[model samples]
Target: MESRSRRRSRSRNRERPYEITISTADMSSKMQTFIMEQVIECLNNRSHPKKMCRYIRERCNARYGPSWDCFVAREYYGSFAYVPRHLLGFELNGLNFLIFKGA
Candidate 1:
């Protein structure tokens, strides 16, 4: 019985991927607006996405050591013009995009 409860608690605390939430009460207030603008500017003018991915991988390494599968792929094969659907955790096939969570 104790082991079963422990297993239930562990399952309850599972990590969620890509969880982004903003808690500010006023999304349109001046300060909030300014911050949002800054974020957009950074996203728009940031360095080449490929280079940025490498930079991100390096930083993540410093904090979490290294991961073999962490990577970035483009929307098209051997191209970097846009982020790939696969990178967003989706599978693509004839006019269909499937997204699922994996354990």
Candidate 2:
């Protein structure tokens, strides 16, 4: 299997494009794209990681039923318990993000 995470440009002169390297995921392609969009949106909004996690979680629950949650950090190491096929892990910029829907 091939991971199609685009070759991100190393230019800091302009805004970084929406690109992520997904490490582990069990979500649909559509939802995966949505996560990317949310990350970019939150980053552009200059939101703090905690606030960003809450915003993303709320947005996700609003769109995809409920029980959504998110965590963002530079070096993330934690346990997770979530609904099947509703978990995603990826890296954006230098942050590690894990978002999931719990029972």
Candidate 3:
């Protein structure tokens, strides 16, 4: 089988546009763990989702390019289930508070 880099190069030279699909399952265990760690740190800091997204983009761009969306989405959804219900609402500082408790 051809290596991924070789396949990419071949596709680039072809006239047809090639679509590459990479799922979380395709990532290495180390990469998945690293991404999860970053997500946990951001959530623990109570950073807004938008800010978290930006941070993810900046941190992951070099390695994952524009494909970091899946990581962010997975983390956000996981957070919803893990975060306390009281902290799961409202938008503040342009950050959607996934957990907000009403007084």
Candidate 4:
């Protein structure tokens, strides 16, 4: 028999679909193109993950305004196929340690 608290916790842990609201205006073609290009450049140049994040943030801020979040850039970086899953979590000296996995 499960404890009442445990049952409640289990219910809470159940995954549920949720809607995320994002402004369509923020996702313009130009913005998408810029993010894609930046992500590809970072991968090709073998940039540190933190550096890539900073670069994207800076560029976005310059093009947009300070009101814009860096989420778009981060999403692009996270989806880059060339980067390994494990490498994403490892950071040293405020920068990601570059590690290439077998292709």
Best by TM-score: 2
Candidate 2 regions exceeding 4 Å error are 1-15
Worst 10 residues of 2 by lDDT: 1-10
> Clash pairs of candidate 4?
none
Q: Candidate 4, residues 1-103: lDDT per residue as tens digits?
A: 1111110111123343222222222233455445445544555566766777677667655665543333323333443222222121222222322222212
Candidate 4 or 2, higher TM-score: 2
The C-alpha lDDT values of all candidates are 0.27, 0.79, 0.37, 0.37
Instruction: Provide TM-scores for the models.
Output: 0.29, 0.82, 0.40, 0.41
Which whole-number lDDT from 0 to 100 does residue 98 have in model 2?
88
The 10 consecutive residues of candidate 3 with the worst lDDT sum are: 1-10
- Which residue window of length 10 is worst by lDDT in model 1? 1-10
**What is candidate 2's lDDT per residue for 37-65, written digit by digit as tens?**
77777887788999989999988988999
Cα RMSD for predicted model 4:
18.0
- Candidate 1 TM-score, true structure as reference: 0.29
